[model samples]
Target: MDEGCDGTGLCIDTGDGEFMEISLHSRNSFERKKNPSQDSGFEDRGSKSKKKGLSVSDFLTRNLFSRKAKESEDDAEQGWKLFGRIPPKQAPDKDPQQITQEFQNKLRSVAQPKNSKKSDIEVMSTTALILENRPQNLPTKDPEEAEKHRQQYEAMVEAARKKELKELKMKKKQKQQQLKNEDKVVCAAKRWTDEILPNWETMKSQKKTRELWWHGIPTNVQGRVWQLAFGNDLNVTNELYEICCSRADDRIRMTIESSEIYGNSETSSEPPSSKESSVELIKLDVSRTFPQLCIFQKGGPYYDLLHSLLGAYACYRPDVGYVQGMSFIAAVLLLNMDVADAFVCFANLLNRPCQVAFFRVDEELMKVYFHTFEEFFDENMPGLYSHFKKHKVTPDLYITEWIFALFSKSLPLDIACRVWDVFCRDGEEFLFRTALGILKMYEDLLLHMDFCNLVQLLTKIPEDISGDTLFKHIDTIRMNIDKKRFNQVLAVNKES
Candidate 1:
């Protein structure tokens, strides 16, 4: 065992109570920058020059060597003394167990640093070599003591891990705030908002303000901004939504209660066009929508809000009625604004130029979307397009959810929110750009994936990545797409 071997970390006690080993992991809200200065602890280990900013004792502890290393004939070549391993001998006639217990006691007393500064990094890095050489368990397999040691080590490690997480999150938040401060959009949004939407209408009428949306909308104002962008003032009023809800409630009750008696069977998932069948389908799906999000849980007010919004839309637009994907769409809206506003937003999104065709039982327009996407995919990403085609994988199989739900189910919520910010600004065209952008961002990974693995990878929500990073990816690929070609495909598909 090394001089100060604790269960998890090697601790050194120079008779004083302070411990030399420190944990490297820390906590934060966002990922820390992966610069070499932040990630690795030790660098240039083989260099002959002395490590700067470390005391003599610190240097010796960092550069300690085993007997084999000390015996190297090249000691003169390295020009550094290597401490030989201690012999099997008594420590001043003291019991080894007492000394071991006292060493652990000293380590426990050594407090963790308040902040993880550069100096702390250097200190923590010194322990890296010991971490690799550290034993998994005590040589003595005393079950009880080993278990106790394991528990203590785990507790310490866990605490350090959590602290490290907090640090990383703080770093991420600071970076974002710094970036946000630099963004001129924040100033424009504030000025425009202070002037109110009436004054902003000057810009809107001229069709100049839509570009402000791609710059990032403040969270508090995004709902209203979207409302303004969509020209949705009707559902913003409470009375209108109330009327829709009243009418919808009656339709919903009748459809649900008489579902079995009517042609709309409870088990049927057939293409639903009638208000009654749509209501039945909506009821069946209401509980299942965003099941994991706390706000949309079974009995929450947000849950009731989702029901009201979707139901109101069903009554308001009996032609489209309730669709399978509308629940997630409605959920996203309710998250952004009040139930009434969300309804208006939902209605506007569905009513956009050709989007309503997506819900038709025939699915003819949805097929157009899929076909156009495949065409664009071929033109832009020929390699991935060929791979997907070879495996008989089509956009209709997976992209239906993405298109209908505005990618609510496909991306992490943060990334999805950022996508929505741009989607509202750019209109329906942005959706395809984003879809292709996502593909382009991970093209290398996609190229290596098998068909089933590719499907799984595409469908699963990725881990919490920085939203700014994804938007950067979206922005890069968004410019490369030929809008002229896209319009041509749309025209051809619509004509067909």
Candidate 2:
């Protein structure tokens, strides 16, 4: 057993081998307090008792030796230091049971009341009412009032749900009716194919190989023959010739005169007719003829449906205005599908995100194709650029028509149809592949010739890239280029 002195000089017996020693100064101070010392050897006992009772020497010794004494002295010094030389009054000691009881009473004051007027069932119903109706002021104390409020709220919710369901049903029925009407229109438009005299397949296969002989017709008979053949017909072919003859404007006349001279002449010495002549003639006729043909002059259901669709498109896109290139694309479609179906294909092509961007008047979108080609040229044929620069041949002169018309004017009819078949299926990537094919076809000529000769060679390329050789080259290029990778490059260019 160990005896330990607490700060107040009370001895406690700790049942252990360890002994806690108290300082002599602490023991003396306690004795003096309990039973005053007879000797005045303790300096100024009256004032000392009044002033914390420990001398500077006793304070130092207690702090050094006794744990309990040191703690008490430290507390006292801290208190006086906080109070600026005057010691603070010590708090009186409280019983542990008394403190616990006081804390419990305070907790009870803040706690929610257990004896609520509402029953558990009523409380739950009232909570639902609060959620449903959400009244600003609620009667929490009376269960009957809360129950009545909850019943009213539930009735209101049921009414709202019924009304919403009714409205939803009405909208769904209306949408179904609209879809039925749209189906009727589509079916009516589709019926014209069955009603028409010749189906698209028969019309596509129709052969009219009438050849006009100007063989024995003298130079003087030429003008007369032209007037007789073209004069009576108000169709596109004659009207375009009439317009060409009437234009007398130097450039237009020269283009027409050159077309007639080279087109009709069998001479070996003269330069061959420019491909532009046939294109210009076709452009004139398409611009003039299609609008009148679309008037349904024959007055049949097939004509009406065909006219409506083609007319609507022509009216919608007046800038393009029924161009000759579209006629080729449309003619190909009209081979497999009825007019209405062909129109749908044409409309989808024009409206689709990939193709629509190419036909804008600003021509800004076509720059992507041009830029892609520039990259291709720089990478694959660096010498081509040097040659182009040397010859001062702008890409715009040749590529503009090639891309815009999809080479419809440049290629013969049969070849153009084959190219368009792939083009419609694959989208704009086919155009690049086709261009690469053209370049590769002429690679031998391109590599051997200088800039001036290159331009002349390319000018003759339209006639050269005519047959199975061209298709083979196009197929080879398509196989070589990863279209998905090219599309990704295009997407990135669009974002930038």
Candidate 3:
């Protein structure tokens, strides 16, 4: 027996019986041939049969192996997954020419008509790979590929440049339109100041003593009375009366009356009083204190009319009754138009559901506003709240004045006017943005200070900053907040 032969009987020797014989167990055994070649063909046929039998198994194994290989390749190809999804790669640091060309190609590919959807992944991967493989610090050789890239780049850049120019022009046009709108408002204000108001003065001055006296007396100044006694067409004036009567308190009324009686037309030779009498006397000069024509003034139909309207409004909306801040807002409107016109604007402002809801004292919309502020503070300036807590400063302490007066006391008149402009145009979002703007404006102080210092710094903020500066800062802050809030809202809506 040869060394290769098993103990089984299936062994065969070559010509001289010198060659080793190997054997395997056979399922069937029959002695057929003595020559090895004659038997070798039989073995070959049997091997071929065995191979044919394994065809399905081999196919399955190879299929699995290929699938595993492909999966491994995909994992390797994909860079690190961010938040369980692959994020778009940042554009590679590349020559401007190359970037422009690549960008153009991408745009062109996007523009190409295709029956099948192209995978964004494939396009991005190819672009990234191309950029990655590109040799850095290569000499400027004008290869055709490079030239093609250059042309594409040039085309894209030209397109982009044109788009930017178009956008700039649109923005310029929009800005011009805005300026025109503002100019119209200012012109209206000036017209009211120069023409409409002076005419009211003439009308009031021309009235009989009894009519003047009757108008001067502030009692029974109801909206209906305003409509009946004043110009019948004075809807704005009547609305103002309604709002004033609805919202006013005794203090505001007394102040307005006093201001009207003690006109500030003359230089004061005597020192003003410091007591409550002084307050009353100061109220008598209401026209001087809350100037701009609509709130308080003596001897003018506009004044009497507005006084009546606002007085009525104070009475009508007693929950917000007599906030000192309303007068300032009213005054701004009055400066811009006739009392009737100003009242209509004010009505539009206050009658809005949001403003009306906010003004309800029992409902305490201010609290909701403070909650929004607290949330903002927590997210953007987390330390501020903790600092405030450490310093024992409640939300009411600072936020009350800011919210109640809409920062009238904190911000200068002009800036407050701009805020009101946006507030009127946009709505409640403007208020939050304004608050954020205030915080951001004091960002330097906010960044450096701990809680105690934060409180102190906020408390000590000067009231003298330019309104323009304040508005500009507020606009910037508001823009950021608007963008973030818009995205958040959009995401939430999408999820829903």
CA lDDT, candidate 2, residue 330: 50
lDDT per residue as tens, model 1, 1-496:
1332223324334334333332122121111113232235544333332223222333253457434443432432233323333234444777889999999988876765545464332323222322222366736557786687777766776666667666767777898889977676667767558754667556654444555666567777777877777776343557878998998887666666676566545544433554566665776777887777766766767878887788888777777778788888888777888887777778778877546766654477777777878777887789989998888788876776787778887787657777887777677778888888778778888898888988887777467656666667677663334556566778788898
Return whichever of 1 and 3 wins on lDDT: 1
TM-score for candidate 1: 0.60
Lowest lDDT block of 10, candidate 2: 208-217
State in Å the error of residue 228, model 2: 44
Ranking by lDDT: 1, 3, 2
Return whichever of 1 and 2 wins on TM-score: 1
C-alpha lDDT (0 to 100) for residue 242 of candidate 2 = 31
The segments of candidate 1 whose C-alpha lies over 4 angstroms from its true place after superposition are 1-189, 195-198, 204-212, 233-238, 255-276, 478-485
Provide the lowest-lDDT 10-residue window in model 3: 48-57
Return the TM-score for each candidate structure: 0.60, 0.36, 0.39
lDDT of 3 by residue, 13-104 (tens): 33342232222333211111132433454433322221111122223343476656555444445534323555676876899999899899
What digit string (tens of lDDT, one per residue) describes model 2 on residues 149-224?
7777778666665666566667768899989866754543343223211253343223320111201122222222
Least well predicted 10-residue stretch by lDDT in candidate 1: 26-35
Per-model clash counts, in order, read: 14, 0, 37
Q: What is the lDDT of residue 457 in candidate 1?
A: 76
Ranking by TM-score: 1, 3, 2
